[model samples]
Target: MLTSIWQAVRRAVRPFAAAVVTALLGVVLLSGWLDAVDWPASGGWVRAHLPALAFFAVAFAFAVQGIGRVVRADRPARSRPVGLSWWVVVLAAAIVVVAVTGATEWLLAEADHATDRGAARVDAIKTGLGVGAGTAGIFALLLAVRRQIHQEHTAADTVLDATEKRVTELYTKAADQLGSGNAAVRLAGLYALARLADNHADQAETVLNVICAYLRMPHGRLSPEVSDRHESELQEAQVRLTAQRILGDRLQRFSQNPTWGGQVDLTGAHVAGIDLDFAGLSYARLDGATLIRASLQYADLSSASLVEADLSHAKLTRADLEDADLTDANLAHADLQGADLTDAKLTRADFTGARLPDGMEFRNGLVVRT
Candidate 1:
């Protein structure tokens, strides 16, 4: 009998508890039938456990609502106790109601003292089904919601990845096209390079020469070497004293535009080093300025003024000093190899230990009065 009842229950539970449809209709139909026939009261246990049955039945419905979520949980292997949710209470109350209605019906049929218990028993069965089936429906809805969210997130990630890849390809194509063009393209490339040199101190400095080359000028622009309101030097001390301390820091100031007039005018300024390496100092001014141990190598100082300036130990290798003035200036131990001094005034300028004007002897590693 136990085995037979178990098989019946298995069949009943197999249909996703949807069999509750018939069970519900039968309960309502039978209750009305019993009322029409004027049956007396069934028993007392049914009325006593009514409130408890309702409480537990509602709890059971809520518990089943969590089933879908629990099933979809990432770690589903762990054991879940029954009473953790009120599902156990729901089941227990249902069982009690079912047993009470069964007993009362038997008494009504055999005792001849009360009416039939069919109505109340049907009601109990209907309540049990609602709690059970409703729980299952809620669980399924939760699972659906979870699945939808997962798919949405996955789609979003895929779109983001594709967008990044496409942007990279477009940028590569743009760079390649820029490389094959003429002077205008070259200027454009240089401008792009400067704009892209944001915050990269070493990299930006490295690209300065490339910018000058794109401009089709031999001398690099001095404006690219320094920025405005330089913060590294010129702090405290004397306005003119700590210039060297922050000179390198000034290399950050430069325009991103391609139209750069290569002219560095530092006329009458008391600077310590006249470093114009690869600078566009065309027709610039430095008259009467102090330039000790200055480095003007590879600079274009064409038609520039250096009249009466001190240029001791200054490296003038590969410099363009055409028509420049060195009148009454010092050129002691300075390197003038490969310099263009065409039509420049060098009258009364000291050439002691200088690299030019043959017959200058190097006596005991110093320029002596020979």
Candidate 2:
């Protein structure tokens, strides 16, 4: 009866033993791969305490399995939820294992040189437990900090996403207002866009481009003739003037605000009587544009391209026109008093009746410095 009982126990344990051997083989293969990849945990303290760590891993697994089985047996139908309490228990178990492993290692090392083995063992145990507790505390603190940083990052991303969505909605609504039939609505749209650009520096160039494109559209000059068409043209001109004012305010020199330093492309745009005084318009492209009676006094138009542009009677007094290309441009009756025209190209440019700076003159359809 004793021999039969022993054989029965061996048969029951055979499958479990085979499973453990297979799991060990898998671990060995995994360790080899980790070693090949130079995994940081494969060396240093981990390598030195490999046996202890492996024992902890196996014991922890068994403990978790047993706890799960007990919970399931008690609950029968309801599933057990692994919560903070479970993690707390796991952490405590890990700390205990580390403390035991450290004490054992210290005790073994002290045994070799110990005159009084028992006292040496007690001292080693105390020192190891203290060090293990300190290390575990530091590890827990680092985990807490990491979790906090992750939560903050997630919240920041959410706020950024919401802000971007709001900006897009505002942009779409403002753009739609620009297409409205009412002049007041269009004017409101221009102001909305300007405010948006002012708040968001990244949107400044795009806003300027939209306003410039609007100015470039075919618009009849304000007419004195009393009619429905004249009334419509008058409203349109007012809207256009408001757009120009917005640009002028943003591009003003010495203004205590973020200025749009990018090039203004008003090519072929007709903006009669537009006010842009003291505007910073360096490198602007106004080629073939109509600027009759426009106020541009003291403006910075350095290196601007005004080829074939009509600026008849436009105010350009004291403007910076250095390196400006005015080839074949019409400047009849335009003011150039005290304007800096250094290195300016005036080939075939018409300057009939225009006021030139002192010691400067237009002779034979060309500007000449006396």
Best by TM-score: 2
lDDT of 1 by residue, 1-370 (tens): 9999977886566353444644664585568543343223443555778999899999999898798577457555533222233443344444444444444444344434325456655554565456556655565676577667767877887996897676545445434534643534433444454444443343444344343232232221233245663342322112222222222222312324323343444555555564556655667666766677778777777788888777888888878878887777788888987777777776777878788633334354433333
The lDDT of each candidate is 0.55, 0.81
> In model 1, which runs have C-alpha deviations exceeding 4 angstroms?
1-259, 357-370
| Clash totals for all candidate models | 5, 0
Residue range 1-370, candidate 2, lDDT tens digits:
9999977986667456655655665575556542343323334668799999999999999999998788568455632222344445455555555455545564546554789888887787777677777777777786687677767877887998998898888888998999999989999999999988888888888888899999888766565465666556788878988998898889888788754657898999988777889888899999999999988999999999999999999999999999999998999999999999999999889999999999998888777879
- Give the C-alpha lDDT of model 1: 0.55
Instruction: Please give each candidate's TM-score.
Output: 0.31, 0.68
Model 2 — TM-score against the truth?
0.68
What is the lDDT for 39 in model 1?
Answer: 26
Off-target runs (Cα >4 Å) in candidate 2 are 1-127, 224-230
Q: What is the lDDT of residue 337 in candidate 2?
A: 100
Model 2 residue 345 lDDT? Answer: 90
